[model samples]
Target chain A: MDTAMLIEKSALVLLLFLISLGVAAYQTYFERKLAAWIQDRVGPDRAGPFGILQPIADGTKMFLKEDFIPAKADKWLFIIGPGISMFTALITSSVIPWGTNLNLFGRDISLQVADFNIGILFVFGVVSIGVYGIMIGGWASNNKYSLYGAIRASSQMISYELAMGISAITIVMLTGSLSLNDIVKSQHGMNWNIFYQPLAFFIFFITSLAELNRAPFDLPECESELIGGYHTEYSSMKLGLYLFSEYTSMFVSSAIMAVMFFGGYNVPGMDAFSGNILAILSIAAFALKIFLIIFVIMWIRWTIPRFRFDQLMHLGWKVLIPVAIVNMLITGLVVAWNQGWM
Target chain B: MSLQMISVILGSLTIASGLMVVLSKHPIRSVIYLVITFFFISAMYILMNAQFLAIVNMIVYAGAIMVLFLFVLMLLNLNKEMEPETTRMSLFTAVIAGGTLFLVMITALRDTFQYGKGYVQVPVQDAGLVEQLGKLLFSKYLVPFEISSILFIAAMVGAVLLAKREKQIID
Candidate 1:
């Protein structure tokens, strides 16, 4: 690679890393503000112009707090726990195609950090690895409640992941390629996959929510029963990392949902835009879709109560998995018929 | 000296972790080591230009199967104190067995190797591995695929039966 290309890619990676951290931090503030609004109260309006600086305040609080390691905890594993959570959450975005290639200084630069052909599968693999952070953190905490929470989180994520994978399979069958960019391209103009594969979309949407362990599927961190759940013993920035990773996964999931189903960055009349304006418009379109999805997630979090553990497992195995498989079969048949292979 | 040397270094780390899987005292630690081993294997698969297989390896082995093993280990409470120290003779026997296995693998690999002949460079295609695997499953390997389904069904039934606890008759 040329020096400029190397520098560009490095800059892109750094930008994405910073953006993800900022998004995660602000997502926490957003959730709090939304929760406040829902409950008919003013959120952190005092913290720098309608709580724009709330995330900064939160960060300061977490950093200044005393870092406490539990006496019974495994120190090395404890440190590694949050590190794994944050790393996995951050790295999963590398394969996601944020927008089409942008031309800069006579070089075409892809918005994504990496574009592996098996992008969707890479996502599934990375998401599964994310379970280790919670599991290890819980195990290292040496608290029974944390251990229980960890087990719940692991099993729940694993079960929901199968349904999530199957849902992605339906999309793959429709698109005929595993690359996220190809999937996005296939959904150009009004040709979004959601129109043809609504069932698959619903299954994927719900399963993604479950996979992220947001409200109604947030059994792992159910405060009523498990007493702060997996990260009960974690204090200061270690705790912040766990919480930040949760919101980061939510943001990433929202972005994935938007890109996969909502015709990512593809406005209805986007073809009419010219030159630099087109690029900026497309990026704005993508950002808007992502924010909308994130808002919907926050809405659901405030709307629904957590499910019972057994009920959560039943939804994954008996309901979502079967629905996902049926969607896949139907999608496959449709694709085959359209291609005259049937 | 190049990316190949970096891969070689990674491969050695993987092999070391794989060895640690058996050598570790705690079962949980062994499971962790095995997970790391799977990760290393996945990295090697990436090096071999099999990104799909590498991701699948991580998803299935390091992610799903290892999580199950960890769950079982945790459920059984097989932590540090539960691990028993190996006797000298058992250790000697393990070493012998490991040595024999290594020798057999090396010899077999050496004997089966064909160097710098009948190798053709083909243009890389973007046909997702899943698509090719699906085609193979439905065509050339249909019978084996069907048989595997039967095996899976049997395994499911066996699992349900095994998990069903016996109830006492109330008088």
Candidate 2:
């Protein structure tokens, strides 16, 4: 509204974007290290200590390489595909409550970029469009495998989104609000929604894995079948953006899970500690929760193998959606019973 | 003044993109332009404080429906431009239909609005919110909602059945 307010909001927006990028960058490093540890081998020790700077090296290589577009490809669309992926991935985190409000210089600073009313819907909406990146990218490549990969990717999204949306309905039903901030606030100390909606949490977690294209659900990029998948024709930084956006979406989904179910920024007896001190500590708590979730995601990636395409579809449509619906009905009944309506 | 200016920009972009949707030779390009137009329309909805409608528009139309369109278009393998030659009768019919639609739209706009007051000054309180919408639907529009869902289920079942290849029936 005012100049100071504009500046503060802009600052928060920039800070959030940088944090997403930074975390996504480090995620690559961490995933590789974790994968190596899973296989009982030392990995990427050349760049920095224990390959900590491996991501930086990989990034530089991507940037300095020759950018090539296939001769028959739609040039503009090819370029914009990864851009769309990166943009959507980065923007989805804007509504996630990073921490509580802070008091500084006689001004209260909200940690989130912008706390929209329908925060969960905003994430879902952006996430649904994420498939366009893979779809258009593969189509623009003019390669058959790329097209097949894109088709698989989009169909997979279309299938899982039903279960994902239904699962979120249970959350929204339990919280009685669509805003992530309200969702987080409702879980003050130990009253997280996961305690009440365990089934929804499980359904949501699996859908999130499929949504992020992490291992066990990475059907679109199944290397055995479709080599390089959607980005088979893409080279240089464009491919890098595709890879980076995956990790970014992974981090964002992890953050979303942390906020929605894991009591984001809320520690036990956190209400007792008030003021800026509490706010700072809450931020740390939120980050720690996010990192733990991301670690678990990587663990899942390495430990479990990918599912067959039919099995993936069956799980999403038959198992998860029905379970989510039953979960929602039971949650509604419980809430009604609590309110003496039953 | 600022809101009106932003609306004007968004409105022009929507129209331009809509035009591009038709004018683009490639079907995929048309789909992309339509998606762009939808985004602009969603932005206008947000400007009107209809955040739920805005995000739902993005989710349903730009996200899900457009992806379906892309999949179908790609499957048809119609990537090359279609060069349809316009005949005299066809051109005349097109012009007549376009003229009639344009006149109807202009008349409707002129009849419905009192210039700026109609769209800007009047605020729609809680109209676009989920809770308000849900309560209204469940109360006043319950029958229609249920019926529509049943209709969707029917259509889905019909599609699945129709998609299956038939086996010969032995009488």
- Among the numbered candidates, top TM-score falls to 2
Interface C-alpha RMSD after superposing true interface residues, each candidate, one decimal: 0.6, 0.5
Which candidate gets the maximum DockQ versus the true structure? 2
Lowest lDDT 10-mer window, candidate 1 chain A? A273-282
TM-score between model 1 and native? 0.92
Model 2 agreement with the true structure over A80-176: per-residue lDDT tens digits: 9999999999998889888889987899989887788899999999998999999999999999889988998999888888898898887887788
lDDT of 1 by residue, A36-88 (tens): 99999998887899989999999999999999998978788889999999998
Pairs of residues at least 3 apart in sequence or in different chains that clash in candidate 1 = none
Off by over 4 Å in 2: B81-100, B113-121, B164-171
Candidate 1 positional error at A96, Å: 1.6
